[model samples]
Target: MTILHVSAVKSWGGGENHIETLCYELKQSNPEIKNIVLCVENTLFHERLNETEIEFQTAPLAYNLDLRFSFKIIALCKNKKVDLIHIHDPSAIALTIIADKFASLPPFIFSKKTSFPIKNKKLTLYKYNYYKIKKYLCVSEETRRVTVESIKVKDKVITVYQGTSITNKSSETDFLLRKKFDIDESKKIVGLIGNHIRAKNLETFIETVNIIVNIKKRTDIIFVQIGSFTDRTEDLIAKVHELKLENFIHFIGYIPKASNFIPQFDALLMTSQSEGIPEVIFESFYHKKPVISTNVGGIPEILQDGINGLLTKKQDSAMLSEKIIHLFNNKELAEKFVTISYEKLITNFTASVMAQKTLKEYKNILNGN
Candidate 1:
């Protein structure tokens, strides 16, 4: 089977990471199934793909409705004899719909990787319900629920949890977080990995840091954020300065293989206001690190409160701070959380399992099941 994966996103984030992971796993498990990626030219996704052996092609997306991108899609589909098209983001859905207008493309398997509600609009509804889309593989159960609300055929939407690849599990890194950031060796490092986007709720991250350091007077913990810096970053930095957390917080912008740093962290912190389940949680599980996240999206599906990890309400800085401190002080509890998380990841959430389930969907779709 030949699959052409589409992603119109410009920056690298969880959705982009999912595509990379899926392709890599599919290649390893089913080599006969050819996977080709079509990403925006010169974008971060394109750059990352260039580093991998994954077969990928790029088209320019200078605007929302760039026919250049559509033309490229047409050429790829015809030349490759593509069996299916997997749309990884909403933008790609629109682009693929446009491409289909000029050419008869393969059936689409759209992956709903976020919990944001589908907008109730004419074009939006039409694009989503487009005839060619065969399956809606959601990242989490919450994502599947949100998608079914707007989808015409509820059966088309199903939850397929995205998992992390554990091919090379190691704590090896060129530099230590403490030495690189000049943090004290005695301080506990709390890591947050996500681009500086509004959905990440970085403002709440800043607020949590403030409450922990300034209000609660905790000098034993440090916050290290690793992700792409965006326009929202300036405001986040300003908030950190305003709260007098310059020394307490470190924004390590856009590190490649950021998950490699997860093993070094005392714990993983996620303050997302929304999610389809961040891949970081799975990575933390593979790294055997305790996680503390806002109870949103598919997170609660995997992270049982006080069982595998701790979950707090979105934007609740006070509660988030308390959880962080609680995890820090309770060593036995942290060990228990990590143990359960690692077992869950190995048993149910590995990339190999994700690929097998996805491959089954592909076969069912092709066999007209």
Candidate 2:
């Protein structure tokens, strides 16, 4: 079977990472399954794709909703005789919805990533495109629920949790990651990794950091945020400065290798107000580290309330701070949670499992099963 992917970005975001992991696993499972990624040119993720065995197709994607790209994409899909087309983002979905109508379109699959509420225009467009597609995929159950309501989709959306490729055991040397930042080795590092988008809820994470430091008076814990600076980062930086958290919190901008850096933290904290099965959840679990995340999206599906990790109410800094401190003080509990979380990742969320499920989905769609 041949699959062609239409992705709006070549940047190393959660969605791109998921796509790369999926392609890598699919290649490993079945060499005969031809898979290719089509993305806009000249981005770092696009260059990284060059290092992989999966094929690449670069085109000038105007705005994400660019219909002009349909001709180019349709030609590529036809030339490759792609049996399936998986649209990774709304922009690509718009293009596919257009291309399929006028061309010899393959069975199209759309990955529904957005779960947050939206305007009626966006909903209408999604509903229109969704009804025209052969299959729909959601990265999390929350995503499926929110998307169904927003788009009024009656179709059953498949939930495929984002999987990770990391399998290395946490080493004592992992602690040296803080030393690289010139941070004191004795200081505990609490961290979250993502781009500086407002939707990621960076402001709330900063608030949680302040609360944790103030309540514990523990100058020993440093809250570190590693990610690329987005448009909202300036405001976040201003907030940090105003809160006098310059010493307590550090922002390390955009590291290329996510796993190499994120696993170094004592705990991974996700303060996002929204997400669809974040890739970092799997990465942290694989590294045998506990996480404190907001109870949003499909996070609860992967992390049990008190078993695998801790969850805080969305935008609740006080609750988040308490959970972080709880994990820090109770090392044994943290370790147990990490161990269980790792087992969960191995048993349920892995590239191999995702690829197998995806292949089955493809067969089912083709057979109308």
Candidate 3:
């Protein structure tokens, strides 16, 4: 089976990482299935794919409706004889709709990696419910549920949880978090990983840190955020300074293989107002670090509050702060959470398991089941 993966995103994130993990797993487990990527030229995804053995091609995405990108899609579909086109993001879905106008492209398998409800707009609705799209692979059940409300055929939407590749799991990173930041050995590190975006709710992260450090007067715990910086970063930093949290909160902008630093963190903190189960949670599971996240999206599907991990209400700084402190203070509870998380990762949430389920769906789609 020959598959062409499409990603029009300029920056790297969980969705991009999902494509990488899926392709790598397919190559190892099912070598007969050929997977190739078509990403925006000169983008971070394009740059990262160049480092891997994965076969890929790029087209200039100068604008949303760039004909150049659609033309490249036409050429690849015909020249490569792609059996299926797996669209990774919403932008790529719109691009594919444009490409289909000029050529009879292969059947599509669109992956809905976020839980954002489909907007009630004519063009947006048409693009999402496009005729050629045979399957909608949702990252989580919550995502699938939201997607079904927008899709014409409810049966087309299926939950296929995105997972992390665990083959290279390690704690040996040269970039030591404690040493580089000059953090005291006695201090516990709480790690947050996500780009500066509205969905991530980084402002809430800052507020939670303020409550823990200033209001609560906890000096032993420090926060280290790692992700791509954006225009919102300056404002976040300003808020940190305004709250006098410069000493407690540290923003260590984008680091490649940031998950490698998971071992250094005492716990993983996610303040996302929305999500489709961020990959960092799975990474933390593999690293055996306790997690505390907002009760949004499919996070609750995996992170049962106080069982494997803790979950707080969205944007609730006081509750989030309390959970973080509670997790850190109770050593036995922390140990229990990590143990359950690690077991769950190996049993249900590994890349190998995710690939096997996805491959089954691909076969069913081709067989017209």
Candidate 4:
């Protein structure tokens, strides 16, 4: 079976990371599948593939209506005898819809990664429910439910959780954080690892810190945030400053290989408004760190209250701060939670598991089942 994976996004994030991991696993485990990645030239995904031996081709795409782009993809499919097209993002979906209209194309499989519901618009439905889109590989049950609800196509959607893989790399690279910040042993670091995007709800984390330090009068927890700040970052920083918790709050902009630094965190926190089951939670499991997340999207599916990880109502900083305090107070419970999460990670959230489930879907669709 031959498949052409298309990703035209210039920015790199979890979606791109998942694409790279799935491609790597497919090449290693299913050598006969003839996996090829088609992306924009010199982009992050393209550069990442260069580090591996996986075959990929890069072609520039400027706009959604680029007729030449459609023709190019059609030509590539014909020349390479590509069996199926797996497009990653919305932009790539538009490309495939246009390309399929112009050529005798293979089936298209859409990978849905977000929990956000589809917009109730004609164009949105038409684009997603395109004639050639044979299957939908959703990253979580929440994502699948939304996709089906929005598209009104229930039979085609399937949930497949994103798998996580961590290489036991050295933490020498992360020493720069401790050295640069001059953090001491007395500080208990509670970290939130993600971008400053709206979905991340970083203001909640900052507000939770205020509750812990100012309201609760806790002096030990040092809140550290990784990932790059975006347009909404100023408000978060100003809030932290206004609350006078700046001394305890630290922002370390984007770093490479974040998992290496995750182990240094005493606990992991996710204050997102929405998600399709974040990979960072799985990484924390592998790192043996207790996780605390808001109960939204597929987060509650993996975070079982006090069993494996603590869950709070979305946007409830009081409850979140309480969970944080509880985890710190009950060391044995936190350790047990992390251990249970690690067990779940090995049973359901590994790269091999993800790749195998995805391959099964590919084969089922390819065989016309």
lDDT for model 3: 0.92
lDDT of each: 0.92, 0.79, 0.92, 0.84
What clash count goes with each model? 0, 1, 0, 0
List clashing residue pairs in candidate 2. 227-254
Residue-level error in angstroms, candidate 2, position 150: 4.6
lDDT of 4 by residue, 1-369 (tens): 888988877656678778877877887788888888887777666776787787888887666566666776788899899989988888888877888777778988889988988888898889998877888998888888888987656798998899886443345564655556666887778888888898889988988999999999999898889886678888888888899987889988776666668778899999999898888888898888999999888888788998999999889999999999999989898889988998999898887789898899888888897
Off by over 4 Å in 1: none
Q: After superposition, how far is residue 313 of candidate 2 from its true place, in Å?
A: 0.4
* Candidate 2 TM-score, true structure as reference: 0.92
Worst 10 residues of 2 by lDDT: 166-175
lDDT of 1 by residue, 33-64 (tens): 99999999998888899999999999999999
Question: In candidate 3, what residue range of length 10 has the lowest lDDT sum?
Answer: 168-177
> Which tens-of-lDDT digit does each residue in 169-263 have in candidate 3?
76777678888889999999999999999999999999999889889999999999999999999999999999998888899887777788998
- Residues 320-339, candidate 2: write the lDDT tens digits: 98888888888898888989
How far residue 266's Cα lies from its native spot in candidate 3, in Å, is 0.6
RMSD, one per candidate, in order: 0.9, 2.5, 0.9, 2.1
